[model samples]
Target chain A: MNAPATATAQRKTQAMHKNLQAGICFWSFLMPALAGLVLFMAIPMVWGFLLSLSHAQNTIHPGHFIGARNYTDLLTDPEFLNSLWTILVFTLFIVPATFAFSLWLALAVHSIPKGKAFFRTVFFIPTAVSYAAASLIARMSFFSGTASGFANHLVGLFGMQPVQWIGTASPPWYWLVLVSVRLWLQVGFYMIIFLAALQEIPRSLYEAAALDGATGGWTVLRFITLPQLRNASVSILLLNLIAAFQAFDEFYNILGGSGSSGGNIGLARPPLVYIYNVALSSQDFGRGAAGGFIITALIVLFTLVQGRLLGFGSKEGR
Target chain B: MATPMLTTPVTRRQMLKTFVFAGGALLSGCARSDYIDGKLVLTQWYHQYGEKGTFQAVHRYAREYTRVNPHIIVKVVWIPGDYGTKLATALLTPDGPDVFESTLTQAMVEAGQTAPLNDLFTSQDLADFNPRDIALNSVNGKIYGVKMIDDLGLLYYRKSMLQSAGMQPPATLDELMTLAAKLTTPQRKGLFLGNDGGITAMLNVLPWSAGADFLVNSQIVFNTPRTVLAYQKLQQLNQGGSLLMGAASDWWDPSAFTSGQAAMQWCGMWAYPAIARAVGSDLGAVIWPPLDAQGVPVTFLGGWTAMVNANRPHVEEAKKFLQWQWIQNRAIQTDWCVGYGFHVPPRLSLARTTPKLQQPVPAYAVNMLGKYGKATPPLWNAAMGSDLTNAVTNIVKLGQPAAQQVAAAADMCNRELQRELE
Candidate 1:
């Protein structure tokens, strides 16, 4: 602080030298991680981009370089468009419902006076169980088209009609089955995150609000709780969004080709399922790869859009 | 694959000095033709059959095959899910299986994945097998694999239900509807048609039976009054109120028929085992309902055939196995079928003459066996089974009209056919 301007100017070069020296000091520690990121993530990102632009996969055969044709076809294709709407509707249905349920559960557990940990664990056991297993069980529970499954048994107990949960419109019932299983298996993990975020807010803010007149519902939520939860909500939103897009394994297992006589309840044919149908079922790798790349792009774009809207990855958040 | 790990990654300078040492080691290993080692292996992949007895065949053949050849060992893999993709992928690699089994198809034969057996077997010998079974293996007069079995889809039913209703199995779409209506009630719906390729498959088969070819010169002529009749009747059978409950009913086990939940089921002969297992005694199968005026029953008969891999190290040895499968294979067929319990031998001679198919399942299903038998309709892939199933399911589940759905579905079939064939 006592150094003169001319001396400060001279010392700045030495300061720059020190910054370089510090970076060099950390070089060995950071090099492997950096190299890994480049070799795996960065390289694959470019490769996927290249694949998205082309129409070939898993073979040496040359593919058409119809730059954005795949994307355009995806945008225009009726089935693809229907799937987009289906996914968008699914995200809308599941995301808010899941967020609301998880948040409610989290707040309930947060407010629980005794044995909150046990309650949390109990609530999360379904989450810990693989969604595939849960969905299979869930499918059985709903499979009471003729007084066989739990749903029909329960309905019969109450003198109510047995309903077909998955035997509806093609695209609709499929997603309906998917979202139900998805939300059941997912809401708990999000609840835990929200609960942790809820706990992170200082008690002083609440106490101050109580002391003042800002204890109204909206005031407390807007001023204190939401402000506190800004980070967790963004993270959960991004995670859930990406998960919704990349959802394959559960759907693949549940609504697979191995149904009772390979029936019409083909619910799992999401983008990945469709891709599998194309590549494996029809032996059209180019088409499947195109679908995969489209899904990946949708995921990335949706993630970024959600992040940008939530002020995530921004300087202010940091 | 394991030997590469034995060598160290040395610098080029060091490698120049150690070249002789590495070369000497490679030469020694290469020269070792250790005949006594139990390492000469043949790999085969098959879909899991009853209690995996088909898998047991691999071990049984290995041990018993010693009477013929003592130097061979076999490894069998029950390809987990979607055998088509796994087989196709494996065939592409240089280190693929030595022998495998798959349903032969003209397109698949054309796809070049199936190895042509024209050099091995004479045409006259192959023609002796059922034409339908051979149709799958033949592409441009070249055979790709041996016909392992002859399977035909038939309607398995509770004879008691049809008797109680005072109606026999119908021969046309009209009689089926009347019978379906008679059997329908809130407590017990008539049948489980299921949503598989049957929706489209029936269209292909019945039309052929009715003298309506679904396609001519590669263009679809699938739509017709009889086809529409099939569609309408399909709708009526699937209608919500009295008959079929909903699309989900399709997935209820066909064994439910013996349990008496479903009065009837349309399924493959493969289901006989499960039905036999479920029922205390042998079950029954009727020919696909509503036979044509001449009483001709049509169905899709198909099966998987054993194939020798082109890249197999023991291709010649594998061919010997294939040849052995045909040599007095009738007894092996009966043994395998009876041993598996649910299966009847695919050979016409064995199925008819042997007591297995004729052993009085309840007035002798073997009587119905020939009556029910029909060639498999040409199919590109089995997924059509699911897609058509979905279409019918969609009609029932979504409350869409059955005839229109059938029409749209026939159109979809045409599209998919064009998609594949082109």
Candidate 2:
């Protein structure tokens, strides 16, 4: 009985010693990342939140506490309101389009038996291009309003006159330029994601579906492939929606001119651009911070609603 | 298995140690650069200039200064793209440059970002400097910046193109319209004010040329009948299809004129050398032609001034460097203004003495600038400038009537000015 009791005591002590070692290892692994997260992300977020509450006019530092005034002013500001609306319109148009285009491209690449890797690489190459570089190419070469621009040259081939792509205001050609560049730059990334999800889909499912008369292309895609990609689709949709709403670079480089004074907040001014102008250009940091929070809240609300409709993050099936 | 597990831990520990050492070395490296004993390091910033040899010239000047003063190091930071916004943001931080060059705006002055240079300049210095340039950089009768160079913004036309079109350089708004129409061809447009439908460069000068000023007696007077007429004329120019809608660059650049994209271009005098190189002796400049024979042709004076940051840790050292570089050293000043780009020296004595100023094309521009040059008012801040620009956009691009846009802009600008004053 004494031997058994001593052995049990020794086992308990060893277990506690093991637990202590595990804890140290866990913290050691997490320390570097956790320190960076706190220093860079957490602190700035808190500082920015405080700035949103104050009357910080010219500087980033918080001034007199003027709670809710910046937020309230945004409700009536025409430029800010227009910017919000512009982003909404842009997201509405871009998200679904990107979804359809990327999915279609993914489907095409997956079905191709020959040179599948080659085609995949070709489609994904644009994801490596920087947004600023892409926007400049769009501005200076492709969608330039001049007769020599690639878009104009393309239109000329169709027997249509050279269109003023960036300069024209009536028909809103800037939207076309903005949307096309974003799609060209981003579609490849989403397509690769969809392709990975497609590859993960079991071959047996298609065989089973084929037995059930799902032989046609549309039938296979509709009855088998899409339902299987629900998780990836949701993620891509959310990311695309958020990115579309936060658009700045292409619009800024193409439509809004560059200067220390900032560019014109004309047509296609997204919420981020408006906030940037308010904070950096006008030096009204309080209002800018408030606008930033409002936009974040909007994005959150949109994601929540989208999730609810799509039943994402719900544990119903398993 | 025991040996492998033991080796993994040892390797991980070695990796962690390496990271820690590397981080400490980096931190020490960053700290050591600015903390040298008994030496004051002054960081001076200049906006990116398009003129050739500008970067090298500024570096040479800084090097010359450090050679003379061993105890102080003048580190010149050349900022590219969006200098005003970047500088404003930097000035808020403790690590901002000690000295910089920029236009003195009302917002900058009110924010207490600029250090007053009253003690630096005496009565004789004030008298010798161009009074207008000095006045532009002063707030409440205290000078804030020393002028480095005076830039002239006006119309630069191809002389051969104008002559071929049977047009002498336009002397009035009416003549400019006729000349523009006559110069239009299948390949090239008549005039390119800017890519943004001429609102960027021509907006301020148009109203000013019509005897409408941004502020008269500290009250907004930009919405006068004359200004409305000027806007209407601009609208007509846009509607007439003679204005170049898009170019490779903006009105501030000479690219459109040099590339033969437009017969005439609105640009700054800094591009004169480039324009002269591209178009040869065919380049001729004129101020924004007057609204009528009764009015005067106008050239907007767009220049940069060197100022010491009030929030800097080494304001005195920075000021001393600025004085030594641009004020006392006449040779460096001449090189800065004339070596890289064609700019009028802000000092009356220097402008008169520079041999380059005696050249025909530069002489013409200098003479015109002296005669019809205008400085933006102290009351006309960036916000006000943006408001006026928006008004111009509505009138010219969106086809909104001038009177309503002008009135709305005037009201907004006046409210901002009042708020700023309070």
Candidate 3:
């Protein structure tokens, strides 16, 4: 009986030692990434929140605490409100447009049996281009206000006079330039995502649908293909929505002044650009930080609502 | 068989020792090689100027500084884009430059970003520098920056275009509009304020030309009938189908004017060399015409100023560097102003003595600048400027009511001013 009891005690000690080893292994794997997240992301977020509450002008450090004044000020300010409206309009335009175009490209590419890789690479090439470079191309070459611009040249061929594509705000023709540039830059990325999802849809579904007397083009697409792509479609919509709200590079490069002292055109100023101007250009860090948080909350609220409606991450979504 | 060497289990102490050795090696490899035994290292920052040779000029100045003071080394950092925003961000950090060049704003002074340079200049030195530049850099009886160069903005028109059109250079806003209309042709538009129309350069020009001051004794004063009338006239000009809308370049560049896309361009003195090279004898410079009889012709005085960072550890050394580079060293100042591009020296004495200023085109520009040039008020901060710029855009492009827009802008400016005062 004594020998048996001693053996049980030895087994228990070995089990405890194995558990200790496992814990150390887990922590060793996790510590670097965890430290990075805490240092770079978590610390800045908390510091930014505190900065939003203070009157930090021309400085990033928190100054006198004026609770909620910056928030109230931004909420009431017409320019800030207008920026919100501008971003909403941008979202309304960009999200559905990118989704539809990307989906269309994905379907087109998937149906092609020959040179599939070629077409896919061709469509995906724009994804590699930087937004700033693309914006410059769009502004200086394609949609320039000059008569020699590509768009103006095309219009001139039709016997229409050259229209000032970017300079005039009365007709807001700049939206066409802004939308097209963003679409060109982003559509390829979303198309690749959709292509991956399209491959995941089993070949058996199309066969099964056809066996059930479903027609080839419209019926098969509507019933099997559409349902299969729901997860990807929802994801792309959310991503596009968030990206639209964060629009800065194209608008800034195309419409903003050339140098540091240059100002962006007020017509299509989105929220991020407005906040940047407030914080960096105006040197009002408190207002800028407050605006940043407001925008963050807005993005979060939008993402949640969108997720709920689309059932994102749900078992049904999968 | 014994355990393979590769399969051996390492103890925690051995692992820590390995990490320690690796860290020491990595750190030693990363150590800076530029360090000397007792030399003080100074960093100076400059915004990239668009003209050719400016980069080389600034680097040469840094090399020269080291030669003058053997114990000190000056590192010149040429910031390429978005300079103001980058400088503002850098100024908040501990490793910011010891000396930098920028326009002095009230917010910078309020944040204690720039050191007062009263001791760097003698009374004679103060008198020699342009008074307008001194006023622009002063706040609360303290001078915070020494002007490095003075850039004067004016109208550049093609003499041949105007002569062929049988028109003199416009003497009034009305005449300017009429001349623009007369010069418009099938191939070219008449004027180019900027690529985005007239919002960038004309922001201050319109107000000052209309006999309206942005501020008077810290009171908002731009919201007046004259200013509204000026906007109305500018709106009319923009709508007249004569002002060049889409150009290859903005107004700051002489490309549109020299390329004959526009007959008249609103630009600065820096464009003189390029315009001379392109248009030769056809280039003519004039002040922006007054709005009405009650107003005055306007040219804006804009340039870079050298300031020592107050928060840096080498504040005294930085101040001395600025003094040596911009103040005491007249030869370097002249080279910096005239060698790369055409700019008026901030020192009046230099401007008078420089042979380049006596040239016909540059002398005319100097004369016009002396008569009508106005520096932006230090109190007219970026936020206030944005409000006015928005007002201008709305009135000119969108056809909004000028009076209402100016009034709204005034309200916003008042609020910003109140914050500054607090």
Candidate 4:
């Protein structure tokens, strides 16, 4: 009891020294990234946020402030609400599917004992492809309205009336095509992470458990795989959630085209797409910035929730 | 792969080389005074489809201009298709482009990025450009751009298809619809009326036949009974099931006509080359169907413009480039139009007397452009009657009632009018 206070002080000094070291390291690492973060991310973000409180156009060099008028106007906009609803629906479907599919792929590849390297390579290869390339292929295959697409070809082979994928009242079916492509593009990356975690699991624990009669699939999975993957699962879910929330590039290229060509039906217009339309196309930067910031805030909030749930990176005052 | 873009052996050599080579000649490029005489550095901004050739042309033209006068060194900046974001960045900057072509919207005028070109262009230049193009260049009676290229609504179809159908191009909307129905088959459709909301604004011309403007004299014209009827007529054609709605809607290769899927498409002259590519020498073009009453043939005109950067050190040189490229260099204009397959010409002579614009098939499109072509209306924000006629697409997406969407489109126009006017 006499030494406890002294010990605590000693711990405090050690912690302070370590924290200072960490602080120095963090800044050193961040300095390089700071330029990019400020120029590409921070300035644009703040500028966009400022723009939201204005009456502006595409060529408006300097617009006047109108306060919260843009947000208020967005609140009144039916199309805006509808676009939000569409994005919410897209997220609800896509995020879960991505996790389950990635996990399954990881499990499949991990269980392969002899050719683990080969399977890992095969599985992770697709992660290199961008969403834009995948989307183009998907659009050509399923979303295309004419028989020029693969879905129509398959449907024709089966002797059915050709169903419209992208050009219909229920475009969610076409939305699935986009989501599935996103999953295909992302699963490999998460699978690799899961594989790493799986490899890190103690072999002795499994052997000891097997000897103690904890030999079945569910038992092994619950005691070994799932427990081991807590960190990886959390990391993947948080990273992927951020990705899903900011789903823009795929939606933009698929809908808006490479340059300023033209739009078809715009079947998969996510929130980003709608907001971009508000900002650039319609030249209302204020609403666009507001929408983008709101999306960022939502992503951060969800990441916090994920961190609380999964205990990623930090193991302190939760 | 977290590997370096360069290999290990050559990394040091490459680094030193880049360090030595970079910004050296480029330094010389920027070493000169940013301003020459009273002429300041002026940046001109515009979007181009075929950029590489224009880059070479402008660069050569700049060098020539500098050699002759040595006053301004216009830095010809090429901004690709992502013009909106980049242009926004430039506009937000303190030393952004002084003059650039822009869509005539209140946002542009209010931003102060664009100064009125009404004063820049002389009365003669204005007269030569036409009143409607003048209008598109203006926002609230102030012209901020020199309407670079003029576009107008024109009727383009397969001449072979029209001939086989045993009919001439329809002179009235009703006859046009009849001809469309006659031409449609299971393998192909009568026309491709499914381009997002693009053709939506053309509702002005249709309603104009009934003596209605796109917007009212000062508001959106879609809610007018005539525009509604036009929508209804379009809906009827859709209901007759003449379209394969799910086909890839890439307008660049307009699938309908390219794949033998569409008999006709209503478009501006801009689509001429693309149409020619689609049909492979079977393209036929004509002006928009004339009204039965026949007051005057009308079509919407659009084109790119060159804006001078007032802050550029090479303002005189840049102005010389703009003059040579836009005014004096007919050969450049001809080359640009022909190279990018641009249908409209900056100058009048390029289309008629020039061999380049005298394409055998699209003579009708050229004729329409020359004779009855007009630019987008000056007060087009609240005045023109076009509603981007394809609002049915969004309606189809949300499963909203078609009537609701029709009304919503009208509301969109009215809202834009109110916002811009305010």
Top-DockQ structure, candidate number? 3
Error of 2 at B369 (Å): 2.2
True contacts kept of 1: 0.31
Where does candidate 2 stray beyond 4 Å? A1-34, A157-161, A260-265, A316-318, B1-32, B35-39, B216-218, B293-295
- How does each model score on TM-score? 0.80, 0.90, 0.94, 0.78
lDDT of 1 by residue, A242-276 (tens): 87766666566555524322433243345666656
Indicate the docking level reached by candidate 4. acceptable
Candidate 2 residue pairs in clash (backbone atoms < 3 Å): none
Q: Please give me the DockQ of candidate 2 compared with the native complex.
A: 0.42
DockQ of each: 0.24, 0.42, 0.58, 0.31
For each candidate, the alpha-carbon lDDT, in order, equals 0.61, 0.81, 0.86, 0.62
Candidate 2 on B1-422: residue-level lDDT in tens?
35675445444566678789989997777642543566778888999998889999988888888799988877889988778779879878777888899888777787788898888876777787888998888888888999999999868887878778777989899899899889987567888877677776677788778877787667888878889888898888877777786566777878878888788888888887788888887678877888996677898887889999998767887888888877788898788888877899988888888998897878888888888898776667766776677677777767888999889888878866775676
RMSD of 2: 4.2
Candidate 1 residue-wise lDDT, B1-422, digit = tens: 34473364334465455656876887777642423476566676776664446676756765665556667666667775567777867766666777788766444554455566666655555545555456656666667787666555666666666788898767665676566667876566566564332343353455445545454445556555665555444544544333333333242235446556666666666566667667543355665654346434566555568887775556787777666664245656666655553344545566656654654552244455445445433344444443455555545445566566556656656755665564
Question: What stretches of model 3 exceed 4 Å from their correct place?
Answer: A1-24, A259-264, B1-38
Report the poorest 10 consecutive residues by lDDT, candidate 2 chain B: B1-10
* lDDT for each residue of candidate 4 in B83-134, tens digit (9 for 90 to 100): 8567766766555765565566555566565554444555655555545555
Question: Considering every candidate listed, which one attains the maximal TM-score?
Answer: 3
**Residue A248 in candidate 3, Cα distance off native in Å:** 0.7
Worst 10 residues of 3 chain A by lDDT: A257-266
Per-candidate clashes, comma-separated = 10, 0, 0, 38
